[model samples]
Target: MGDHDINEDHAQASDAPPRAGDGPRTAQAKGAVSRWTRRVHKIYIICFHRGFAAFLVLPLVLALVFVAQKNHFGADQCKARESGCGFVGNEDAYGLGIRLGVYLQWLSVFLVVYLLPSEERSLMTSLITFSSALMMAILVLTFGGTCTYTVEIIVLLWTAFMTQALASITHTAQEIDDAGIREVPVISGLKRATTFQLNLDSPQGMHGFQSGSTLVEMCILGYAAWFWVCLLRGAEMVFAATPCGTSLFFFARIQDRKGIVVISALMTAVSLATLLFRLAAWIFRTSVKRWFSKRTYDMLGAVLVSIVYLPITLIAGITYLVPDTWMLKMFPGSGGREQLMVFLCAFVAFIVSVAGIELLLVWNGISDVYGVGSTGQLIPLTMGLVSLMPILWKLLRRYMAGEPLVPEPASNGSGLLIRGTALPHQGSPVEMAARQSDREALQLP
Candidate 1:
């Protein structure tokens, strides 16, 4: 009986499931699987984040390439005819198509902004609207009466708007961090560096302003200023050379050396005046800390800058309205010196304009105060129609079947509505707590 009982015990022990870590091969397999899972997870996270940038960048890149090719062809034609080109003379269906793509891109941006949380949405909308308006004004002044270059102008406007929006977003993120939200150490450092580089505000404490790092930051910003000025000037030359218009006149009369030189000189003077005013304002704010509130200073700064730029705006309008003959008489020369002066003045104006606008936006909080306008509303309304088609079809089918217009909430097997419950709520209390802790640690909303 004892032997039989012992044999039954041994059989039962052999039939039971194997314990964890019982074999070398099993442990090795688990380790390998865990490593692969972590690698895949890392890869997925990178791709998911980078996908957003790719979506925005790829379309713009293609559009630029297409427009550039068209411009090249137009330039060749202009050379063959040995005449200037104007907007009315250079009508191309391809340019119109490029403009359509730009519109679609703006719609995409608007839709994405709509999907964001309320605070983020408001911030993004404000920045986008302000940037859009500012860019539009700049483009109109730069390429007034040159409707043939509309494709280039549209592309540039979108690019500038995105640049401002993204920069503002970064600045806002840093503010959020300072308000208690935390980020990864490396990421936080990078954000701080970027904010410092872009913002005109002096950092707090003597150490911050006096540190060697401050000099490095200034140098970097200077390099950025140089780069942008070169880019804008290059684009200006390219657009001027490209064919357009009815009797083949240069867009913006850019080929008219004297006119271009005068315009550039005026722009440069206005830009410098604005910069000087900004500097004075900055000094006042720093020296007389209690003179006026920060908001008051910002408001006054914006008003003063606008006033400083008003003369240039008026001159540009007059130039646009006046006949070509009168303008030629007013500024009559086609010398190499005039061309050189135009290039030099343009470079300086571009640099100052970039700096002044950035400082104005950051200091005045214009982007924060502005809200989305008619243009913003039109974008989503136009784009959302396509997205609504599937839902509309579903509703129609439901109506035909005599069902309720609004569907009921879906429930899981556990009899709980799934609509509002987060995934963590489905787990045990301990698991939920652990997940909550993890989220808090990561500073997730």
Candidate 2:
């Protein structure tokens, strides 16, 4: 049962006389509860604040490296097949670099949020987390008009989804923290579940949650709309990339008056226009027409697109990676062709990424640097992997250990947000039990 239910029961009980047996039982429970809560609190308090700081620092440093390497060369496969000397026909690589910059800034915001004490991460943290998502979603929408590579589209959508998922998890954590949930609910034993699900849509779930604010409503609506748009756009991209996918897409288009193309153009135009408007609002306060301060609109947009839609995009992206078996069942040989194209496109992208980084290193006057003669070709790849090492290490360690390598900011913060709506202001029962036991046993009030 939820905390509110428990509170109601207590209120009802208070109106009636207590049973003769209750006083002794209540007294007996107090000592044990006090002892447990005290000990558990100490155990959870053993957090490595420094570790969280380090996590934030590494991403920021690498993000800078990624931005500096913005100069791009053409995709190697395109250079080999189309032009003898060089090719600059497609600006995909350039776009990818810019997107990475966007990714870096978003990542920094996420990390900075964790730097503050969990309790302090209120609506502002929610904004920061969701805004990062919105920025990326808009970028994807803006680019959806032109991008058609099968593998690249898959990667872009996949990355978008994963980033948003992480952001949502973080946002849920902040909400829980704000709601004063110090302990995650217990399902099994004395051990606590590190991560539990939280239902962001539930106002009653959070103790002090109030959703009367226009910003919150906008966030909910905006996120839902963006998610719907991205899913449609991703489908369109898939259709455009594959021959089999395209034939069906066009047939559908024939039925729907070329809807995919229209969506692509409309989405790109609106996303671009929204960005420009945000800039104009900031510079000249043009959002005065909306009757709210320009700042409020900014906040509203952040919550809607970044927090809500970002995660939805991620969920949709995962569906795209589903096996082509359904298509194969319809046509025996078509799947193989699509698979080959994907592999080739992936290879092209890998070559392009490495070349872009290497060119940047050379351009910055790093002559014949660390890996030039023997491992020259591998230099860019090496740095890229190195930049990702910190994140990779944690993920790999978690995989091997079957648990998180580092503790979350809250005792129960590391894992999934449990789909909970109402929790007591004190925390879950396990938290209450532990806290009570600790305090009583240790002679603390």
How would you encode candidate 1's per-residue C-alpha lDDT over 1-445 as one tens digit per residue? 1234323422432323345746987765565444433333332222222222223333433433344324323444335533333222211221222223233433333222212111232333334443444344433434333322322332344335343434222222233322211121112323433433332132222112212222222222222232233233434432433343211111222334455445445444543343334344434433443677867754654465456556534543443454556544433332222223323344444344344433322232222212223354444334334333433453465356554432222321111121111222433565446334322322222
Question: Candidate 1 has what TM-score?
Answer: 0.26
Over 4 Å off, model 1: 1-102, 108-445
Backbone-clash count (model 2): 29
Span of ten consecutive residues with least summed lDDT in model 1? 412-421
- For residues 1-445, write the lDDT of model 2, one tens digit per residue: 2345323422432323345667876855564344333323222221111112222233433432343123222354323423222222222322334334334433433332332122222423343343445445434533344323332332333333333333333434334333422322212211211222234444334312211121222232233334335445545322122222221121122113256446545544543333333333233222233676646754554443443235434543453465668535432342232333333344444344434443432222222233223332243234333334444453464346454322222222322111112212254565445333322221211
- The TM-score values for the models, in the order shown, are 0.26, 0.25
Q: lDDT values of the candidates? A: 0.33, 0.33
* Model 2 weakest 10-residue run by lDDT: 42-51
RMSD of 1: 27.3
lDDT of 1 at 224: 26
